[model samples]
Target: MRAARYLRLGEAYISAARGVLAAPDFEQVRLPFYGLLGHGMELALKSVAARTGWDDERLMWLGHDLDWAWRVTLSDAGFEVHGARAVGGVIRQLSRPHHAQAFRYPALLTWPLPDPRCALAAAEAYLTLVRDRHG
Candidate 1:
């Protein structure tokens, strides 16, 4: 997985999320789209980390940083920060200090379908961050 390819997938994930959210019938399709988007984002992150030869410690640090960013952004929007806390806890538990031989794609993929309002906010924020950073 090339870094550029991962970045491209990240972009596509964000785009797909935007498309799903912008549609009027999002409720009907949110689960699958969210799952796919989450999987894609997780893979993209792992891909980029692998391509960069990041040590497990670095990956764990990156996950922590992203979790912090997610928490801050969600808090700023008045959403319950517990979801971010849970995600962060999982990262702490799963990420190895040296290297993660097996990628944890399921971490984000297994998250329950978010409440519609929170999901919309999170999708918008996630997409915006991806676009601004990767675009």
Candidate 2:
């Protein structure tokens, strides 16, 4: 239940991000876009973990660590991702800034951004998988 909630919330954030990206002033709002995407990934991965019966305490331990969450989902829980490596590459790219609050805060640096489409696809698949298989 909690897992599905996280997945739904993650989808909402990503959907909001797409709206932000569509705006004319999108260049000036890049930070918000990045932040939303990172946070979305975080929630989606948390959903995967929670589906496996991990408690709130363990989930909190992960915090904003998208990479670890993705790892747990991919290798441990065995969620079927079409391009696991590529999706992982996207998660690892977002993990550092997200974990450090860099995306939400003003800790911007030369962040090597990955394409969100892969991550987005992976997240959607995760959401669907958890809802269908677990429920």
Best model number under TM-score: 2
Residues 13-126, model 2: lDDT tens digits: 878877877788877887787788888878877788788888889888888888888877777677877656766777888888777888777764567876655655655565
User: Which stretch of 10 consecutive residues in model 1 shows the poorest summed lDDT?
Assistant: 97-106
Error of 2 at 111 (Å): 2.0
Candidate 1 residue lDDT tens string, 37-105: 454445445434544455456544545233443343344434333344444443333233112222223
Please report, in order, the local distance difference test score of every candidate based on alpha carbons: 0.46, 0.75
Q: Each candidate's TM vs. the true structure?
A: 0.45, 0.85
Structure candidate 2, residue pairs in collision:
none
In candidate 1, list every pair of residues with a backbone clash: none
Clashes of each: 0, 0
Candidate 2 TM-score, C-alpha based: 0.85
